[model samples]
Target: MARVETLKRQFFKCLGLLAGCTSFALWASQPQVVEKADKTELEWGNVLFEYYQKDYFEALIEYEYAKTINNDTAKSDYGQMLQGGMLLSYGQAKQSQEIFDRVLARSADPLVRNRAWYYLANLYYHKSEPEKAHQSLAKISGPVPSDLFPEFYHLTSLINSDVENLAQAENILSQVPEDSKHYPYVLFNVAIGQLRSNELKKSLINLTKVNQYAARSEEHASLSDRATHGLAQLALKSGNLPTAWANLQKIRTNGLYSNRGLLTYAWTAIKIKQFNEAIPALEILQSRDIAIPEVQEAKVLLAHLYEQQGAPRKALKSNLISIDEFAKGINRVAEARDIIAKQNVPEEFVRNLDVIIDDSDWFGAQPSIDYQKLTPFLIDLMSSRILNETLKELSDLYAIKKNLENWEFQSNEHLLIMNNADKKSISKEERKAIQRSKAIQQQLSDKKQELKLLMLSLKPEEQKRFQSTIDSIDKEIAILQSRTDGMSRLSQPYKQPASVKKEMKDKHNQVKQKLKQTSRLIAKLEPVVRSLVNEELDKHEERMRYYWAQSRLAKARLYDTTLMELDNVTSNKESGEGVK
Candidate 1:
């Protein structure tokens, strides 16, 4: 029995030494956990194992259980953080925030408090409260263990972006270790933050790092494409055309760039004066069936190139087609308005239908034709028809004026004879004659009043439009009045009132002159204006025909121009080099 006890004691001593060495090794390996632990916490070991195994849900359950047994505030904080992180992994952002808040409020140990604050900041940031998140992160003030430094820097960078404190955010991100799992992510955030702050060169550096570190991540792939495109844009802005082109080419290879990317590339090519190179890309964009705004722009650009290459008709046709396809296609309303104002289907269309307002002879009747019926016909008129129709209407206006003048002259002569008969005696025949003269004068007065009223009623805009006609009628009426006043002074046949003949003649002449001037001016201006209109119509017809022929008969037009030059050149060659 004594020999067995001695052996057992020796075995226990050896076992105690082994346990001491094992505890020392564990402490050396994880000093942060070891120094703070009062006992061997199997719960932390289990929780960490679950986390490493990617069993985040089970790890959270274990951490919650660990929190109940954790006497140290720091350990409890770690457990709560683990729980919150697990909740975040499951997309329970609100629950994660609540746990992080509890850890921050309840944990009193410095390491635990700082960690809780850091994670709580991240929680707030994830919840879009970057200001609150930044405040929480600002509380961390100690040497961060390597494992926690990544989360610290990343969270700091994100919170910096939230508060628009990109520069500080960049500094925090730079402190992260190079070999960290979050290195690439931090670099990307630093670059993006620097970009937001307009630190292009610095941003470029971080972006470069991001490209190197995140090569296998989605962020790496996307960041590469964006950085290349961004560099290209910067190159273009700085006038480095070749570099811009090279960068844009790289961007195009990356599938992440959109049509807008394509457009930028094309425009950059244009800036470098590589018009021909731009043409293919622009044409490809133009040929798309969908009416994307860029497609319209591409068509416009292509059309412009065609124009510069001696293809105005082609350019014009493209513009017309684009307008028809989508009125809002090009996103240039003012440009469209100007184009329509200047070249909208040609001015000749307005002139072609023989739409004339006759101003000559001042009588308003130009066969009393409808102006509305003519608008469409004018728009559709052949170049020759406009000229013919304009002349015909002008003639009709002049003839109508002459008829009106003859009727006025006959009425005046009859009134003069009746007035003379009324002045002779009180005989039945003389009384009847006086009555006839009075009635005739009253009718002439009424007609004059009606013409004066018509003149008075014209709106200013309308009056200005017909001012030439109005002026002419007034001058004619003035001359007629002078002649009538002189006649009345020489012979007053009605003694009842010689004043009546003067007044009646004065009013009649005024009415006649106003009406005549209005009609005549309308007639003259109508034809003159219509002639201008016809000229415009002819021009439009020429343009329309040119565009139609160019689009459908390009070969014919090109051949026609080349044929004469070719013949001259050939004849010269046949004769001699010196032949004229």
Candidate 2:
């Protein structure tokens, strides 16, 4: 059996050499796993069958059985690498890495080593260690499968932000033999790399090559769709309106991109002032997935189209639709509030939405309907009222804190002056000075009370809503009093202990956070309410238009039908009289 195995390897090696040096190198490197196995042959065969059927775990069992055959290094390495690759496919990265590491250490054949390296590089890429992946790729400098060279360059191109490597990636792809099975894939990756590098012209050239190659093959419909869309984007970017529109029209007509492609097409239409042309595309977008940002942009653009068509009111109605959509998006509202911090709510609200919604927002604020008063409709639909209120409350809180700090500093200064007087030695005039110090102490007490009252006024609801918290603070204040002397002096240390200060700060922060949260909720809800009003208004408008169109069409059809009947009756009477 050992002699027969040797003969088989010698024959296979000759065939491999004739196939090419790359194939020979690969075959020489790959471990021949089949062994003079007795019961293990049946078990491993069954495992191979199961692996083909995608039953990885059962196949894994057979793999283990075959590997357990003592003294078969090839079988063991093959089993481990196959299992590792399967595990990697299933997202078990760490286990896959360990298994591949063992395979690399034991495998003597270049082919198996290259395979292991490829898988390891992929694992590293998935783990987000692209640099490590590039390093792993570097180990396969020996004769490799021509088909894998493009993928190698593709991955290397991803190692940096520069376009220089992208050209190298393209050169690698161009090396594929004309008869290579993976020619289309090489071209696709090269084009995608070019696109990333912003070499749009070269990207288009490669994509066109991919399209032509796939067209000749009668396979790869999805690849064709991708290439078509790629060309459309290129055309759009290059201001080749006719060509871009034509390419996008292919995707739209074939219903390939469905909702997504049509949305892109609509923008192209809007770009060329073909406002009405954009309507149908926008309508298709409206009927599809509504959550995508593109759908929202379509709505805004649709409104602009309507405005361009001499319907300003319809335009505002459209913008209002987007505002309502965004209201439901919690993250989007948070984003808007962030903007509100830097800009006024009303002016910035309209314009910020323009920016956030899409670049079409650059068209600036579209004219709204001529409506007197900030109608609950406009308020509910168009305003970020809640954000405004929250901002005001926050400003007031800061102002009150500043006032409190000033009062505390002044009171402390006055007390320190009194203490200095006490420390001084003087005559009867000093006794008079001490009386003056007493008056100053009284004034300081009154001023402290006033400051306390001011703080309470700022948080008027705190005593009622947060009674326990207020009581806790009062208790701490009382404790501080116990530690101080009543000589208009602080019996407690003037400087607060870290623990005490931290406790006070924590309580203050908790209250502040709660207020901010409440204010935000209120702010967020205000737009929702306004949006509800706006939405209701929009719905009413839509229904009215629908009903009016229906009514007019019904009337016109009925009138035509009545006129036909009358003419038929007259013709019948004239015929009867002539016959008589």
Candidate 3:
């Protein structure tokens, strides 16, 4: 259930999956052990079992198998639809689309068709195609499963809100029971739609409802964090410093929005003239990984805050550190970019994706970087949203590639299982002797031929001079050829029967086809992944360069300030000395 929810969070931006997220959890929460489960039920049940356990690799493989059996069956439409939802969570958009579309076309059952339409509509909505979403939604007939009611209404409300049809959206939203698990997600999405329409008053009210709900419950900590942050931003815009500060305080220190919250928290304190509070917050932010843009800004803010507190030396010290740090970061991004540009290394991009698998608060304000491949310097470069989504795309591509590899392996393994195997081996001595002597024999033959050609143009004296060399070469070639001939004779023990050879050839071709399929996918995918990674590296370099320039300018201004102050003190001392 948690794994499904986590995947939903990752993909909800594009899939509009929040509506159906609770349904999976409900599925898991049920009593799943059946004493005499039907064979088909157990089969599809195992797929969901693996998925609920968060073993997505095996689950997807199982689902692929189920699809082969379940295709074109009305009874299997539900399982297919469920797997389509799972695929959507996994960011398998194209595959999910096919599954849903297939369910809609073939399944006469309203439950199955309606479920497909709702998923398709949600996918369209989250992708910002309201017209397409509405078209999909319009295909739905009267009755749906009780569990799908909230999702349908919530999804409809979201579309209406997106179109600025606030009254209709509100009516649809009211249809969803307030106690439903999906209500908060509904409120959050509608509020965002309101925000887009500049309906701040309505948006604020909805965000406040979400914020209040998040505060009271621990279920949706991330949504709570977002709501709290949104409320703070709204408060700040309205000059409600105290309210903004209060909301900022509500965000978890270790939460996804912590970095952004802290930054805003500091400025909110400053606005309310709480210098002591603001200073400590800024200091904490300055100590964080500068890969976050907020952290980068914090360094400058801290320096300026120190200057504001009438501490020029402290400000200058901070600016100097900023200059050095930005310079190092700029250089690191450049070096990493050059390496990526020169070499095609998929492992480098894959390293950035470890955080996605292990710690997937990818949509959070501070994305985690568990493996900083290339260099620690490129962490900031890979932290952008574009790169993050690209990483998801790579994740899907890798999953498909892995599935192909597993299929290829299984096909080869099956040939062995069927007892139709071909064993091709050579003795150690024979193999080594053949491999070693073959190259030397070729070189010796060429050398001997060259010598004969030279002898043809040379006098008898020249021929005599080269004869010993040619003799040495001839001896080497004779020895190598004898070793090669002996190894060949030993290796060519017996020929296979024609029937066995043909069977082995056919199986081998099957294996080869699988290999080709996997190789082709990798050959196509790696360049695209590398290109996106390279672009992020380039952006990181550009950002670091900008920060370095800013730091340098700040450093110069601080130095000038120090020099002017020192000169003033010196002049005052001279006047005092003259008067004395």
Residue 126, model 1: lDDT of: 55
**What do the candidate models score in CA lDDT, each in turn?**
0.57, 0.56, 0.70
Q: 2 or 3: which has the higher lDDT? A: 3
**Root-mean-square deviation of candidate 3:** 25.8
Residue lDDT tens for model 1, 1-580: 4643543454345344433433433312322434445443554777778888977766766776666775353265566676777676545567877877777776767776676676677666655577888888788777654456667887787678757787787677667777776767777777777777888888767665665643676655666667666777777777888988986776543244444556777898778777777777776676663223455456556666766667756666665565444433222322322332332122332323233322133224333333332232233233344354444444434444554566577667856865876666445654454454344444444444444455456555654644564354444334434434443344333365667667777766765885677485544545454455455444444444443344334334444556877899898898996674
Instruction: Write candidate 3's Cα lDDT for 187-236 as tens digits.
Output: 88888878878999999998888865765466567788988899999989
Query: Which lDDT tens digits does candidate 2 get at residues 257-276?
Result: 45557777888887887777
- List the candidates' TM-scores in order: 0.41, 0.45, 0.64
Please give the TM-score that candidate 3 achieves against the real structure: 0.64
Location of the lowest summed lDDT over 10 successive residues in candidate 1: 344-353
**Which candidate number has the best lDDT?**
3
Error of 1 at 470 (Å): 99
How high a TM-score does candidate 2 get?
Answer: 0.45
Worst 10 residues of 3 by lDDT: 13-22
Clashes of each: 24, 12, 0
